[model samples]
Every structure is written in C-alpha cells, then in structure tokens.
Target: MKTFDHLSVIGLREWIGLPELGIDRVRAKVDSGAKTSALHASDIVTFYRDGETWVRFKAHTGTRRHPRDVECEARLVSFRRVRSSNGQLQERHVIRTDLVLGDQRWPVDFTLTCRESMRYRVLLGCSAMLDGQLVINPGQRFVQGFPQTDRTLRG
Candidate 1:
C-alpha cells in the first residue's frame, strides 16, 4: 500500500470558513468532479470600486427551513459562463476569497449563483485542490472536523 502523507484527507462534506467575508461556519460539499467552486447567493449586484468591479450579494448559509443570510462584498474576478450540473449554461459572477478548512487556509475562486435546491450551500471544487494538497475520501464525511475560527477570543 502507498500513502501520501503530504496531502490532507478531507471527506465528501466538511465545515469551512470564509473569514474575510465574516462567515464563521458553513457546510461545503467537496466534489472533485466539479471544475469550479460555487456559493449560493442572491440579490447579486455589481458596482464600481475605485474604477474596479466589485460585487455585493446575500449568501445563504443555512438550511431552507432555517435560513441564514450573510451579506458579502468582494472584488469581482470576472464573469464566467459555466454549465451547471443540470446542463444549464449561465453567466456567473466570480470572486476570490480565502477558504479555511481545518488548519489550512488558502485563496479560492467561487462562482456566485442560485443553489437553493441543492443540499449544500457551498461546493468545494477541484480547482481549489489543484495544488495537490488534499485527498478526498468519498465514503467519509467531515474528515477535517469543523473549521477553526477566531470567533471567540482565546484566553
């Protein structure tokens, strides 16, 4: 048997954090099949920030029965035409943000779109794991545990 100790093992689902956007906790579906990550967003609007494009939207981070909204604003990376899992082509707003999963934190690009019908609000795609830093265990869940956050001051 061979092992890659340099890679972090993550399950099909994990808890993650987007500190720059003030997101303390959110469930994400780790999908290597997905080329790009996505976030469930609504009321998406674009504006100019110092002559650069910026986006503002409301992200749904909770279940449909218990909805939680988080207002987020980020510099627009670009508008990408993506084919959804259902085979629908649509233009989506892309934004770069730091993703915190367990002890590892790194920048990731996420496409903002409506995923109301999906089970998970966030999707961690293959591009975010392209650096060969992670190995996904399909049969497991939450292998990295909950993402560490500084929400509570350590004393």
Candidate 2:
C-alpha cells in the first residue's frame, strides 16, 4: 500500500498571486506553523455596498510607510482567535478567497490583520498549501514571474 502525499512542500518565502482579486506576483511567506493564511490589512471596515456586504481595508505590500486601502466584497466566513509569534492572541476576521500558486489555483481562507512589521504582506499557511502542489525553495526567490511594481494599479 502506498501512502498518499499532499503538497509539494514549500519554503518560507515564495511568490504568489491572487488572480480573483487581480493581484499578480505578490510575495508570500509559506509558514507551516500557522494554521490559517494571513494578509496585511489595516483600518478594516465592513459595510454594505450596492446592497451587498463589502470590506474596506488598507494594506502595505512592499513597504510599511506606504499603505494602500483596497475595497473587496467578500462573504464573511468565520471569526477565529489566533496567537501570534510574540504570543499575543487576537480575534481575526477570516474570509474565503481564491489563491494562485505556481500553476495551480485553489480556494483559501485568509485572515485580516495589520502586519506592518512583517517583510511580506501575504503569509500563506498550511491549510492554504494543501494538495501536494506548491514546492517552495528557501534559497529561491520569486520562482515564477516578477512582482508588481505598482500596488495602486492592482485591479
């Protein structure tokens, strides 16, 4: 009998894309230690737009000084309490969305948080890296395409 394998195993840093949100070539940290994927978001405000539930938040991609507030309409999935590396437990907003890694795309749940100090704005966790797909090379950076230069123009 053969044991089924899942996920090609990725390194700490890798390039990822959120095609559903029109984001391409965004740097993401693959942290198996984390249970849920996290995205750097600030000033998170949830409101109704066009009679639909939507969320508006600011995100700092490449730099912490420069933050871009992006508005995305996502269905509220669940609320979870997560503990940070510093041992701080906080309630976070989780939403289900699509993520593109290498040549594969799948649905993933991302938590909203203000990760201003982190190097990468996007952090992909274990649940998001399932199915024996992504293989992250630690020594390698930007395995696929180049990162986007303009965050304001992400549409």
Candidate 3:
C-alpha cells in the first residue's frame, strides 16, 4: 500500500464553494479525464468593466427537483474552443475564481457553459487537481465533507 501524505484525498463527488461568485455549496463532479473545469452557466453576457471584459451569467447550483439559481459576474479570462464530452467543439467563456473545498481554498479556472442535462453544476477537471494537492478516491463520496464558512478557510 502507498500513502500520499502530502495530498488531500477527495471523493468522486464533493461539495465545493466558489466564494468569489457567492456560491457556498455546490456539488462538483471530479473528472480526471477532462483538462478544464466547467460551470453550468446560462444567459452569458459580456460587458466592459474598467476597460476590461467581464461576464455575467446565471448559474444553476441545485438539483433538478429543487433548482437554485445564482446570478454571478466574473472577469473574463478568455474564449477557449473546447471539445465537449459528446465530441462537439464549442467556444466557451473562461473565468478564474476561488474554489473552496473543505479546509483548502485556491484559484481555479472554470469554463462557462450550459449543462442543464448534467447532474452536477460544477465539473472538477484535471486542471483543478494539477497542483498536486488532491488525490481522488473513486469509490468514495464527499470525503472532504462540505466546505466551511469560516473566514480562515477562505484562503
């Protein structure tokens, strides 16, 4: 047996927080196969803020039966042409924001796209786990538990 003492172990599905976007507890699906993380966003609009491009969109954060919508705005990182899971290419709006998982918090880039049919609102891809801080346990779920609201964990 091997131990990754320096890395935190998380399950396939975990509760995450996007503090910058006012998202406190959104379920995220950890996908090691994907290179970029994605957020379920709709009604995406771009505007100028201080001469820089910014994006505003509505995020669906809840389950299908009990839907929750959060209107969010973030600075546009770039437009990326990414291939979807179904082998379709599409241009997506990219934004960088802080992601809070359990006691750890860090900046993670997420591509904005409509994922109305997906179960999870946020997709945690390989890029988000590339810092060598996370190791996923495919057989488990919510290993890190829900993110705390404490200010100290906001880092």
For all candidates in order, the CA lDDT equals 0.91, 0.70, 0.91
Candidate 1, TM-score vs. the true structure? 0.95
Model 1 per-residue lDDT tens digits across residues 67-153: 999999999999999999899999999999999888788999999999999999999999988753999888999988777767722
lDDT of model 2 at position 24? 62
In model 2, the Cα lDDT at residue 94 comes to 81
Per-candidate TM equals 0.95, 0.76, 0.94
Q: What are the per-residue Cα lDDT tens digits for candidate 3 across 28-96? A: 999999999999999999999999999999999999999999999999999999999889999999999
Weakest 10 consecutive residues of candidate 1 by summed lDDT: 146-155
Off by over 4 Å in 1: 152-155
Tens-digit per-residue lDDT, 3-69, candidate 2: 4365454556777766555566567887877889998877777877677666666655565565554
The per-residue C-alpha lDDT of model 2 at residue 30 equals 79
Global Cα RMSD, each model: 1.5, 4.5, 2.4
Candidate 1 residue-pair clash tally:
0
Sorted by lDDT (best first), the order is: 3, 1, 2
